[model samples]
Target: MTTSPALDGPLTTALVGTRRFFTRSQVSDDKRSIHTEGGRSGDAFYRDRWSHDKVVRSTHGVNCTGSCSWKVYVKDGIITWEAQQTDYPSTGADRPEYEPRGCPRGAAFSWYTYSPTRVRYPYVRGVLLEMFREAKAALGGDPVLAWASIVQDPDKARRYKSARGKGGLVRSSWDEVVEIIAAAHVYTVKRWGPDRIAGFSPIPAMSPVSYASGARFLELVGAPMLSFYDWYADLPNASPQMFGDQTDVPESGDWWDAGYLIMWGSNVPMTRTPDAHWMTEARYRGQKVVAVSPDYAENVKFADEWVAAAPGTDGALAMAMGHVILKEFFVDSQVDFFTQYNQQYTDLPFLVALEDAGDVADTAEGADGPAYRPGKYLVAGDLDIAQAASENAMWKPAVLDARTGDVAIPNGSIGFRYGDEGWGKWNLDLEDIDPVLTLHGLDAGGTASETARVVMPRFDAYDGKVAHVMRGVPVRRIGGRLVTTVLDLMLAQYGVARPGMPGTWPADYEDPSTPATPAWQEEITNVPAEQVVRLAREWAQNAIDTGGRGMILMGAGTNHWFHSDQIYRAMLVLTTITGC
Candidate 1:
């Protein structure tokens, strides 16, 4: 056989010369070797290089969310492979050392670039039929046989549902299944009233469309939707009562500037991740941290002091601390401010005495007389020792009529009366009147006369211990009392009361017994008693010492309890007591 010149070169020599005598099968076998090595195959070298480039691309790793470069290899004007170049920046620009270009997943672009399974071009069914003639021939007589067998028995097709043979099963279309589900939904909605129809599937997996549909259905149907907790029976009713809404504590930012931070039943360092940062910063700045809880926690780690308390005794503890603050002159400096701003403090002693003296009326200006109401005011007296000395420089005994509510000021001293009715009835010696009755009034509602009677006597007596007991009695009688009894003691012990100061009575009486304690106990929380007391004391002291700049941070741990609302109320009372 003659050799062709085209096959004699290094690129094609294997196809020429003696290879010309080889049979077609031999030629095919030898051609496979060209891909291995030392073969006269230009295509093989190009393919090998292309394959190597592809491997490099697959192995190249990239960092996520940072700059990275991609290298592309081309042969004969065709992109053969691509890989990430970690040595260079992805953006082809300078980047910070911390910035990483492309993640590992992004670097493996070959899977997406050279995938054979990817649809390169759209294929119509007609084109597939023309291209797959050999496949059609392979299917052969099976399809025809199936059609012929079906045609042979119309009765068998009609009775397919009841058929039992191997090929007797009938295939139903997807439309039928969809129709069945649609019908079931309609039926359920009609039968159960929309509220009873649980739109979610039994399985937990849900599609966005399905979730939107369910939400829309409930909204349109005006159904009483139950929260996920209700469905699981883990929903708690205590939150609303304890915090006043869903959470305890107001949305005010006043606590941030507090000189002293009081934490009760709360583990802020562990639970309130974001807020803890600020707390730590505050601590570094010399802010005092006091923690009160039944159990010690990480939050206590940062606290200057931690009080371990018994559970369900928070209220009693608060009262005890109120006793201490009032009797010990611990909160004397802030007593004037508290009495002015806090209705509970203003009404105490005075209101109780009036109630005891049977001088208050229930209706406004009715046949009975002027009705006593709870009062709220702001302290306007000088809080410093010098201010007290200047104000009390001269002292005189003055008596105000109980029925007329008028104060009789001696010539050298100023006589003071609150509201339009004036001081109803005041004795120079307030000790003669029962403190509790005078403050609460005869109608059992609190009046200014009652508060004046009770408070003046305690102030005159200057005994914090007696003031503490008397304060607790009125608060115990009226449930939602917003004032702290400790404040009264603080005022009496500190001698913050001045005869002509701006202290005034509030027009409303807070029932301290009904909505305050029992509700706190039953609806708001179940805090340990010792912790509550500790918190009250810490708060009172902080408020007194900090000049009403005490901050309290109540976290989820404390507010999550059964009596959280009461806890908040107690905290509020403490704040009010110190005029914080």
Candidate 2:
């Protein structure tokens, strides 16, 4: 290529000495102009930023659940600022529109990236480095040998451990970090079991690739990747307890479809900053919001009513609410909402082996499954529930066969799907088949529970009864041990008083006038009986009117309880009845 007149000029003079833009084809300019405020033109201001040369698109790898994509502005290999990326592909017309997502804390994340406390390089405690070096010197510089020497001697290892907080960290090179880590793994795995040498990292949901890399390495080496859910108190055990599975929530956008919203415990705006606007927008769409919290939290402002029960008592409130809805709205109403939904979906229709588990005084203990194990829901098979389910998905829960006075295995449960065809293994429908929901003929039919072991297994029996007599599904018994429905068991489990009910086993605990009454719930939970009744009635009515369009949003505050299953079951009871 021929040289331009600009490049033909003396190189030094054209490049840096007042004359700018010394390219082969472009002219130079000082770019001086009083074109705007501060007597500076846009060109001059833009050109003055000498180091702003490149931008990289990336995201903060913080362990937050909602890690938004970011565009990182870089200059001289250092990040300057980051903004949310707005070009994600459209999911579909069926979903809500997307927006640039980020929280205030995440938006200010750059402060941490460039902070003084940020990690500059791999480091080991000063004392540990010196110990490793000395061991290396003595052990012929073999990394594995050096690590073994330090570890085999507990005193030497403890000496380095003691220096962790006291000794300043010594800068480490990449090679040294990798070598030391490899050697330590080799030594630990040799000395202890493979599972003993575990890998622990932060939430993988934020940055899956990083987690996968470490997990893959450990998995390849036969080392266990430690679970973080329970350790970090983040696992929602309630989901598994109620649904027999976990993680089945709809997207946040689904809130727009809900007509009644119960914002219980979760502060959506505070915790879900990116999606919080959707909730506010949902409110604009005429969704009624109820906030359940001990304090008047920020979200309370958006709520139509605030049920401020004391902390740690949210479970009681949920149970009380369930009681009111079950009795007043479900049982009393002609819709038969609770019973119909129970048959279609829930384990409420399944027979519960009501062979007197034991005298468990406390519902809290019952919830935890220590004081009383609510008898297993009975499954239909020639074999007992155990032997039948002994094979993969072999145990099938039986619904009462209203005809033939026998138990019929339904088409949708795990067992039936496995036994039937190969497709749709998890399908949950009762469409072509009608299964008996009540144990009314359990004994008379003589087709089921002819063997005592199927009706009442003695391995788990306790001294006293945990349910009232009416709670039992009035099935023929095996030598006097009666069968019951899970719905009945749940009623008794929640301290519902069944007073004046004749032959209600566990007579010591029943008060017919007290069970499920608003007064009882109000006493258990500090929430007023009148308010509880009102909310329950409204909740049921709204769901029924809208065909189950109500939504309940709960998070850590409710699910963190040790006996969280009770709260979950209560919510499940409500949701199931309304088909929500």
Candidate 3:
């Protein structure tokens, strides 16, 4: 509020021809430099310029799972800048905090929002717009007739379709576009069916209001709503096949809990940028990381081991690992947890009929022989096992209860999922039924059938060497039907060389003679047999030590292949065997 006597003078020009004036506040002891007074004036300009009227929490529209919150600073009703919100709840004391959740894309969203090429309104193809305008003028402004006139002409339709993706889009009015869309939907319903009028508003998770609005309109019009989730080329078909869900992955937060992680074709740092930190943090906390890729991908930098596999041979590598896991964990040493998990959760205990459905091949008279080919699961209906009132007995699979040595009908088979369906019997309630995994020694009042050597069609390394691998399984007579446990067939199918188990089993991990062995996979995958063997052993051991804390993160690189389902199934089967 008051000035010193030294400042009682006109503001002296410190710098020539500039408004900046400064008084020598202090002289350095060296006398080479001097501290100035009026230098603080420029700080006020920056403080005013950076000042904002208000701040609001917002999210970027970049279609990521993070959904991070940002503090958008607004000045004069315009967004000035954004900052990542730091008030996220603590994950835990052990895990690294999830503050600063934004990425470069989220930070630069305001620039993209105001970019010149960004579409601010509805647009129509220029060629289509021309045809529509002409039709509209000729049809007396009836949008339906105008649209029909243009589409009904094959030349006009083809011309507009051909013009698409060539950057001829012109600005469109919301009213006109909405009218044209509604008219097109009406025309499509009338010409074809309501199913032809499909809607494709995407990413319901990020834009639920917009997605639901389009979905509601489509539903009202009886039009099909195309899914954005699981219909893409890279969609993981194996997830639904194995777990009955489109994506059966754990939450991103669970990455920290894994003791061993295999990045199978997933470039997490590039694809899942927001959650990539969790992987590094987990690694920091001594979790082992393995990267399986043909190229040195971005994720490989974070891995403790890198397996350079040949392209499209992921299934071979997976099956090789599965072979190793089955041999070491299940056969060589029967892990208690793995055995219990297989017995309780898997279909290994289910029985398979030796004969095709409704067809039983004749064998030598009274020789305890018959059925050549394996059919569907031998259900409860085939054994005259009574079900609860109003239950579908045919859908319930019959399992041999090891405790009672009696054929038991389980309560949670797919058949129990249907009939008398308010809630349906979907729970995994064994209800005192301890199913036998293998019927290798079971006898049902009659002589046991001789071992069945089933020939499985095998394709050798995608190299046109097609052959059949014979697997010998134990079969028995159950209720006058030749049958075998699924475990017996699977062991033989997986080429597990267990002692006393007859099959086309590999001699060892180094055996190239048998298929799905590590040495066999080396020819296809170009990955070292020793690496696969070591990874398998380590993965299973880690799962055993950590109570199944092993995880595999896979992505489009594997899922984009033609045989992606088989590849995923091989990987999943490896986990199933290791109980990971």
For residues 57-97, write the lDDT of model 3, one tens digit per residue.
Answer: 99875567678889998888877788899999998777788
Clashes of each: 80, 13, 1
Give the Cα lDDT of each candidate: 0.41, 0.62, 0.76
Ranking by lDDT: 3, 2, 1
Candidate 2: tens digits of C-alpha lDDT, residues 182-204: 89888778778677776775567
Candidate 3, pairs of clashing residues: 395-415
* lDDT (Cα, tens digit) per residue for candidate 1, span 1-580: 3335455466665543335365322333334322122444657765764653332232332211122455666555445656555564232223122122344444445556667866555332332222223232454623333323332446533444244343432333455334334443454456565665554321112244554666666667655544432332212333443223443443323434677877765576554432455566567767788876767788888888876545544543443444445433332233545544443222233311123313332211221222222233111121222222333322322222244432222221222222322244222334332222122222333322223223222211224332211121122222222221333433432223322212322111111222122222222235443454455566666666777887666544444435544545545545555666
For TM-score, the strongest prediction is: 3
Query: What global local distance difference test value does model 3 have?
Result: 0.76
Give candidates' CA RMSD values in order: 22.2, 11.3, 7.0
- Name the lDDT value of residue 514 in candidate 3: 72
Could you estimate the TM-score for every candidate?
0.35, 0.69, 0.80
Report the alpha-carbon TM-score of model 3 versus the true structure: 0.80
- Model 2 TM-score, 2 decimals: 0.69
Candidate 2's C-alpha runs over 4 A off are 1-61, 67-96, 109-112, 123-184, 231-234, 332-334, 356-373, 383-393, 403-405, 419-426, 432-474, 477-482, 497-530, 558-570
Which regions of candidate 1 deviate over 4 angstroms?
1-217, 225-256, 311-316, 322-334, 343-538
